[model samples]
Structure formats: structure tokens, C-alpha cells
Target: MARMRWSTSHTRPYTLRQRRRGRERIQALEQQVAELRAQLATQWVQAQPTPGTRLDTLLTLCSALLVTHDLPAILQLVVQQAKALFVGASGVLLFLSDTTGQMLELRATSAGTLPPMRVYPGQSTAGRAFLAPRAMLMAGPELALALDEQQPAQYAELSNLLTHWPPVSALLAPLRLESQRLGSLVIYGGSRAQPFVPRDLPFVQALADMVAIAIVDVEERNRTTQLASQLTQTQTNYAEIQARLDTAQAQLLQSAKLAAVGELAASVAHEINNPLYAARNSLYVVEQDLAADAPERAFIAVAQAELGRIARIITRMRDFYRPTRTELEPTCLNEVLRATIELVHTHLRHGHVTIQHELDAQLPQIVAHADQLRQVFLNLMLNACDAMPTGGVLTIRSTNEPGDASAASIVAIQISDTGSGIDPEHLPHIFEPFYTTKAQGTGLGLAISAHIINQHGGCIAVASTLGQGSTFTIHLPFTPPPTVVLSMYSTLS
Candidate 1:
């Protein structure tokens, strides 16, 4: 009995230990089973279609839409893809007309015998879809009933148009980008067995959203291109207008300066005339009193000549402000040019300047004051000679510019010199009186030349490059009108 009792105690402990180990093994097996169950559940969920798959599809559709730029192509692609998403389905896309916002026009269709239809807002099924905020799914009977109740004429028209390929059900979604309601997209099912379900609404709506995005993007890009073109044109016009304004302002300022200088010159000439006359008379008397053979008599003669020259200069100054009417006659400009050149031939020779003439042989005669024209030519020639201090070619050209319907014939004379050119900063003021770059200049040569040309109803212009050369161009009409001559004489007198 003792040995049996001892054996029972030991067997009981071993059995208890075995039970604990078996229980632990069962618990471990249960844990493994739970883990396996969790893994299977995850795999099953992964295998099924989820929102992420839809998102990836939407992203792919968006990428496709973004690469396309044409509006019609984009709409056609959308409808075709939507139709492809469901079997036995036809798709149509409608958009608001750009010209008339009140009407929605059929833009693209995948498969249908429907005519090109224009629908008014709040009138048809597509219109209602466009006005709605979210997507809608309607059975074919319900759609027809609503169409008949809302618009009988439209329902009859649609029935006639769709008799060949009638719709059994439809999924509609509004094309909207933010607050802008662009249009609507509709997918029509032909078989009742393959009717679009509620789950199809989100996908159709996504396509509609893509259409809206594509349309808005294309339109915005077009508008941006137009605005950029307009901006460039506006800038060009502004620059041209500003340049004209600057020219006008400079002309006005020049006129003001000339008027002020004329008044001052008249006053100074009046003040100096009396003293100059007295000195000339006294010198003449001294010359008459001295003996002809006396050395002092030669000095008196020179004094009289100097006084006479000063008087002539003073007279020219007076004529500048208050010119007398010099009689006009038929004058040959070519002849006048020859005479003036002869007078300055010595000076030009001493300056080592070579003169080249390109006179027009058939040049016609114009009515002008020969002496005044000669003086202008002389001044210009002398100035040209002075420009070429070291020696350069002086080219004189004369051409007769024929008249057009708007302009009369004129004579154009160009005098060009290969000499140091005028500085750009000094070119604008060169014609103003008392403006000169030479130390010994009287500063009245160009100013008087401009005035003389103005009185003759002509114009003079100069073009110079700082390092290249200079050209002075004079344009004279074939004849000044009688009224212009008379007006000029009257104003100057």
C-alpha cells in the first residue's frame, strides 16, 4: 500500500505537468490560427476592388485628359471611355454653347442615332443633370415619364430620334469645376439586364469632373495667350505715342526759344546802330581830310573799310529779326550752286577739301530770291569746308523727287562730308541761335539758314553718326504758292 501510494503521488505530479504542457501547446496552436486568420483576411481585402483602385483609375484618366488640348477631342475621348466602361452602353456629352449660354449643345457621342440637338436649361434630362449638384441614376421608364411631363414636344422629338437605339437606363452626372456648371454627361444602357447601378454613379461623376477640368484648362490657356498678345501690342503702341509726344514737346520748346532770341536781337541791333553810323561818318571825314600821299591816309582808309564791314554785319543781324521782302524771280538752283562754289573755291582749296558734284542735269527752275539762296548755299559750303579740318571729300547731290497724289514735287539736295561727326548730345540744339561748338563761330549760321529755308517754304534736316560722317539734306518745293509768299512777306515785314 506504501509503494502504491508513493507511485500514485509521483504519477499525479507527472500527469499534472503533462496537462500544463498540453494546454500551452493548445494555446500556441490557437495563437497561430488567429494570426493565420488575420493574414487571410488582409489578403482577401487586398484582392477586392477598393477606393484606392478607383483613385488610381481616376488619376490615370486625369493624366490622359491633361495631355490633350483640343476641346472636341477631349469630350469625344470622355464619352468613348465612359461608354467602354459598361457593356451595351452609349454615352453622350453636352456642353453650354459659348455664344449663347442658355442652350446646351451636344458635343460628342459614342454610339447613338440621335440628331444634333440643342436643349434649354430646365427643359430636358441632360439639362436637369447639369443643374443638379451630384450624379443621378434613372430607369428608362422614369426618364421618359419625366421628359414627357416636363416637355412633351422634346419627348416626342427624342423618341423619334432614339427609336432605333433606345435607352433602357441612364446614369447622368453634372460636369462641374468648383462653382462653374459647365455641362452634363450621360451614359445610356440598352439592356435592362445590364442596367447601371448606384456604384456606377461615382465613376461617371469622376469622368464628368475630368471633362470640366479639361475644358476649363483649355479655355484658361487660350485666354492667357490672348492677354499676352494684347499686352505686347499695347506696349508697342505706348512706346510709339510717347516718342511722338517727346518730338512735339521739343519742337514747341524750340519755337519758344527762337521767339525770345529774336526779340533780344532786335533790341540789341537798334541800340548799336546809331553809334556804328557815327563812327563810320567820322572815319570817312578823316580819310577826306588826309593827303592822298600821306601814310596816315592809308590808316584812315582801312578804318572806313572796317566800319563799313561792321555796318553790313549789323544790317544782316537786323534782317534776321525783321527781314525785308526780297523780290523773287525764276532762279536756277544749279547755276546758283556753281556761282557760290566759285566764290568759296579759294577757301576750299586752302582747306585741302575736294568737292564732288552730282547735279541733276534736268533740274527745273523755281521762283526764289537768288541772292538769298546764294547766301544759304555759301554758308552751308563754308560750314562743310570747316568740318573737314584735315581734308575730306565733300559730296553734293541734287535730285528731283516726283510728287504723289498727296504731295507736290520737291527738289532734294544732299551735302555729305567725311569728317568728324557732331555729337549726339549737341545735334538737337545745333540750329538754335548762339549755339555753336566752334571757338571763333558767330553761332548764327545754322539758325539763319533754318529761318531762310522756312521763309522759302522748305525744310532742312541733318543726320550724323559720331564716328562715321555727317549728311545735311534740304528739301525745297518746286514753287512756293502765291499765298505762302505773300503771307511770309507780310509776316516778316
Candidate 2:
């Protein structure tokens, strides 16, 4: 067997990159401190500060300005310190919106007259250090004049706008707040001096952090404003929906009252019709008797007729109050459809309206509460008739509905009218108790009918389009009509 060779894993040794970077950064910070120590050392003897330097000064000052949510103010202070110390040049601050992000936004500027109007981060030696976030100092070829003159067109323009006097050398560094990387700052040489040194990274990093904190503050302000706007919009939508619901409820209530009155009137009129006919015939007979010179007979006839009118009125009162008993039978859906049409025939006298029928001849027998179904169908037909006040097509249809493996079958009675359709806004509340569009209409007829059909295990659905027309289809199951059961024991001989 061949001998197998195996290798042991060894941890990789630390590289010189991190070590060298640390040493250079510390050296840079010392140089920056040495430059600032002369002036800052005197500031320890606290003097009467300006209003902006009072207690809670930065917070109060930042809150007063809406600039970048005041993030720039914080960036400004960081760069100001660098300017105070490194009296050699002007500086800039830039921030990254997030770590590992592409965006680099210019946040602050230092005291100086810039070279010209130019795109930021021009292809200069200082621009390179800013992009790399590393320290750099140039004293030789890096300060070549011909190179600076042929700058990126955009940057050259921005440089011209920035200053009447350009710095000879500059320093660039990044700003970060906690995990978020805000941006960076660039400081250029004030007089004809060499560019920043590699030893400047430490001081630059510290200043970067202060700028980052200000960026955090500004972002917080922006978020607060957005949240407030969303809340206001939400509240407005809630109010509008609530108003529509309330209006719909009120309309339904008024509709119920009209239906009740209509039902009562129909019953009274039926009862009175009979007695009125008898009285009219009696009057004709009395007139004939008076013409034959029998005036006394005519007077007796008139009195009897007067008494008959009173009896008719009382009978109507009794019928109106009595509960109607419905007969359950095997009723043909088409017959019910025809009866409903006939009931509303007298109401639909407009010559412009056309009646259409498409009754399926093979419809199954519908075992239903006949009288109640009649009343339900009648109400629907009348509603459809009323919709077409100026005369339109009233279509009545009936068909057998397919059933499952159950005891009985189902049928559908559909009434469609080409009349003014319901307003779309009222569609949801149309079936609600007492909702109606008619002026003299009590919205209750449909509501009561809906309830009765529901109790009988059926449903009514409506489909309407404004200006087109409306259709109401009632679904009746083939369940046997329920019968009242009474428990009574009797003895029979």
C-alpha cells in the first residue's frame, strides 16, 4: 500500500499592513496635536462664551436650523477644529449614508477662497487620499502645476467657484457615527506648502467621528417629519369612510317606514273596493225607482247603502291587522313570475316600458311558501317597475338550478329591469334594512322579504350598474315547507 501524505493546518501569521497602518496613524495624530496645542492650551481658561456655546449649545444650535437635519452643523464644527489647528490650508467634510455604501456626500467646508468651480474630489493628490481614507503628503512631483491645470472639467469648474485663492496642499479624511459611515472632510494647503503627510490619519479619523454624529442627528429629523405626514393622511381617510357609513344607515331607516305604509294601504283598498261597487249599483237602482215616482223606496235604498259603506271600512281594518297565513304548495316558478308581473302590471302603466320573459320550460317544481313567495316576487317586480319611470324593458326569467345528491332541487327567479340603476355608492347598503332611493318609498319591503326568504333557507342577490339597469335574483331551495307542530292529547270514542 502507498504511504499517504497529510498536511497539518497552521494559523496564518498577522500581516505587516495592519501593523504599519497603526504606527503611521499614531504619528499623524501627534503632528496634528502639536499644531493645535499652542492655541487650544490657552482656551482652558474658560471665557464668557457666545450664545451658541452656552449649556446644551450644540443641541440648541442644531435644532434652530433645518439644514440636512442639522447634520452639516456637526460636520462644520469638526472641520472648524482642523482649520483652527492646521493653519496651513482649507478643509472639507463628506459623509457616507451607510457602511459599505457607494454614496459620498459633501457635508462641510473650511475657511478659504477655493480655486474654481469644479466637481468635488477632483483628481488631485488630496482627492486620492480622501477616496482612500489614508494619510498622504506631497512635496515633489505631486505638486506639478501642469497636472492641476488639466483637471476633470466638472471639478475644475467647482474649484473656480470655491475660491479666488487655491491651497497648495490639502488633507482629506472620512466621518463615521457608530456603525453608520457618514462622509469625509478635505483640507487643502493654505499657502504654497507641501500636501498633507502620512502621519495625519489619526487626527483625521477622530474628526471624522464627530462629523458622523451630526449626520445621525440630521437623519433623525428627516424621519420624524415623514412619520407625521403619514399619520395625518391615515386620519383623513378614516373620517371619510365613517361619514359614508352613517349616511347609508340613516337612509335605510327611512325606507322601512314607507314599505309598511304601502302594505297597509293595499289591504285597505282591496276591502273598500267591494263595498264601493255595491253602493254604486244601489244608487243606480234608486235612481230608477225615483224616476218611476217611488220616492219612499229610494230613501230606504239610500240608507242601506250608507250602512254598507261603514261595514266595508270596518272589514278593511280587520284584514289589515290580521296575520296572513301562507299556503305551502308545489308552485311552478313561471306561474309565480307571471303573478308577480300581473301584481305590478297596474303600477307599470307607462307606454314606453316593454315586458320580456325568458322562462325555462323544464324548470323543476318549487316546494315553497306560495303566498310569501308571491309577496316577495311582487315587491321585486314593483321595485323594478319603479326603476323604469320613463319606460324600459322589464325582463322576468326562471330556471332550474342544478342540485347535489340531496332530497330536493332548487330554482331561481330573476327579475331584471332596464331602469335607472342604483348609485354605486349605495350598492353596499342597498340590501340593508330600510335602504331605498324612492321618495315615497318605505325601504322596508325588501328588508322584510329578505328576512322571510332567509328563514326559508334562500338568498336574494342584486346586481346593478348606474344608468344601465338592475337585476335581483332570488334563490329558493327545494326544502319542504316547515309546518307548525302542536302537542295535544285527546280521547276518541
Ten-residue stretch with the least lDDT total in model 1 = 1-10
- How many Å off is the CA of 101 in candidate 1? 5.5
Give the per-residue lDDT of model 2 (tens digit) for 1-493: 1232323434755469855766677777777778688656555324323333432443443344334455545555655666554545444534343334553434445643323332234344433433554444444456445236444773554355334245565555545454444455666654553345555555555555445555666677678777788778877887888888777766655455435644665676677768777876776676665756676766767676666645543432332223233335677878877877776776776646678889999987766656567768878878887888889998989888787777456788888999899898987767655577778876656865775566457788899998999999888887644531010111122
Score each candidate by Cα lDDT. Answer: 0.76, 0.59
Please tell me which predicted candidate would have the highest lDDT against the true structure: 1
lDDT of 1: 0.76
lDDT value, residue 362 of candidate 2: 94
Count clashes in each candidate, considering only residues at least 3 apart in sequence or on different chains. 0, 44
Supply the TM-score for candidate 1.
0.74
> Across residues 1-493, which tens digit of lDDT does each residue of candidate 1 receive?
1111123355345678777776777777788889999998887656444666666766777888889888877777777677666554644545554455587777776643435667776556787787888999878668766455435554555555442246777787888899887888767776664566788788878778878889999999889989999999999999999999988887877777677667877788788889988988988787777777989977877888878767665655566766645567788899988888888888988999998889899888887767667777888888888888998888888888889999999998888888888999989888887789999996778888887777778998999987667898888888877765784455442
lDDT of 2: 0.59
Clashes by residue pair, model 1? none
